[model samples]
Target: MKPKKKSLSDLGGIMYSTDPSFVYEEENEIPEQALPNQQQDLRVMLDKKNRGGKAVTLVTGFRGSDEALEKLGKMLKTKCGVGGAAKDGEVMIQGDFRDKVVDLLQKEGFKVKKSGG
Candidate 1:
């Protein structure tokens, strides 16, 4: 199934250019590189605000590409033996595993800190 175009901006912002010589230039974005594990300052916290009171362990402060983020998330999930998601530069584990997550990250060479209750 084809996806729907949400706005005029999706058409490259020059939908009605009359000039025959006009050419659409697509913007190329470069993904940010992942930092070394030792340089990563990650925070592990327990969050329960929007999940119907079910607490989740959220790891934030990752500065890396989505692929790297997903890989890290997968590793965390596998090691923690829990189901969760990794996206938007954050990794969410299904339950309250802040202490465990912090220890895991620290062992992996990341500077991890436990934040929040």
Candidate 2:
């Protein structure tokens, strides 16, 4: 494959224009992390659609940073005594721990509901 072109952001520098009116200043600022919405409810369920008949506990409707999601996933995995992965704003636990996860999330101030059988 041919080498792809890089954008200004990929280059990591500010743009400059020949015109005196145009100027670019590089501002390195980290955005404030978003807090999870209390009004919004999270869903926990079991999914086995594409895993060759293996069930995975899925926690969705998480509205926060990936780090926060991973933290929650890690906590759940620890509590359930199992292993899993967290990514793409969703947490996946290796087994069926719907009730356990729901209880845990409720304790953590998350409005969680069991979805799907």
Candidate 3:
């Protein structure tokens, strides 16, 4: 499926260049490689600001691919038996499981730090 264009800039600025020699170079972005578990620095914290006062354990500072992040999120959710989301390089596990999350991440070989209140 084609993605919806949000603005004129999304369509590329130079739509029709009169010069025959003009060549439009498309931007190619390379996805970052996932770091090894031992090399990863992760932070686990408790957040309750935006969720109607219900706390969530937030895991951040993950320098890896989205798939890896999702996998880690799934593992945490399964172990904690809670529902959450993994996106934008962050994992949100329902409830304040900061201590458990830290232990799990540490077991996975990630250098984890407990931050925030």
Candidate 4:
């Protein structure tokens, strides 16, 4: 069997800079906030692979803060009467609720569309 690939985080402090004068100092620049993708069209897809044949409604194209994502996720879960999580700029609701989710997103002034077969 092939060995699994190591992610960047897996390296864990093993990185080294080759430059002799490379002074590693954390930047003091202010971080820019993520703007919500309210005007962007979002895609709602039903994914089953790698999930033991169970379906999940994946709402993608979200660009905003984690708080916003969680808020939206909570609202969707409540509306659908199901459980789910929001992370990495995506909202995942348990079960296949593509149509319902799309409708709800549209009603919330989001440009959402049901995607995938």
Best by TM-score: 3
Off by over 4 Å in 4: 1-38
On the 0 to 100 scale, the lDDT of residue 87 in model 1 is 84
User: Total backbone clashes of model 4?
Assistant: 0
Q: Candidate 4: which pairs clash?
A: none
The sequence of per-residue lDDT tens digits that candidate 2 reaches over residues 1-117 is 112238877545655567888655545656445566565478999999999999999998887666777888899999999999988768999989899999999988889999998
Per-prediction tally of clashes: 0, 0, 0, 0
Candidate 1, residues 20-72, lDDT tens digits: the string is: 99888866756566789999999999999989999899999898877888999
Off by over 4 Å in 1: 1-30
Considering only N, C-alpha and C atoms within 3 Å, which residue pairs clash in candidate 3? none
Cα distance off (Å), candidate 1, residue 109: 0.4
Question: How far in Å is the alpha carbon of 89 misplaced in model 2?
Answer: 0.7
Please, what's the RMSD in Å of model 1?
6.1
- Return whichever of 2 and 4 wins on TM-score: 4
What TM-score would every model get versus the actual structure? 0.74, 0.69, 0.76, 0.72
Per-residue CA lDDT of model 3 for 5-43, tens digit only, reads: 588697688678889999988656466777899988898
Sort by TM-score, best first. 3, 1, 4, 2
- TM-score: model 4 vs. ground truth: 0.72
Which whole-number lDDT from 0 to 100 does residue 76 have in model 3? 98
Q: Residues 12-57, candidate 4, lDDT per residue (tens digit)?
A: 4547889998776643645436554567568999999899999999
| TM-score preference between candidates 1 and 4, better one | 1
Cα lDDT for residue 115, model 1? 82
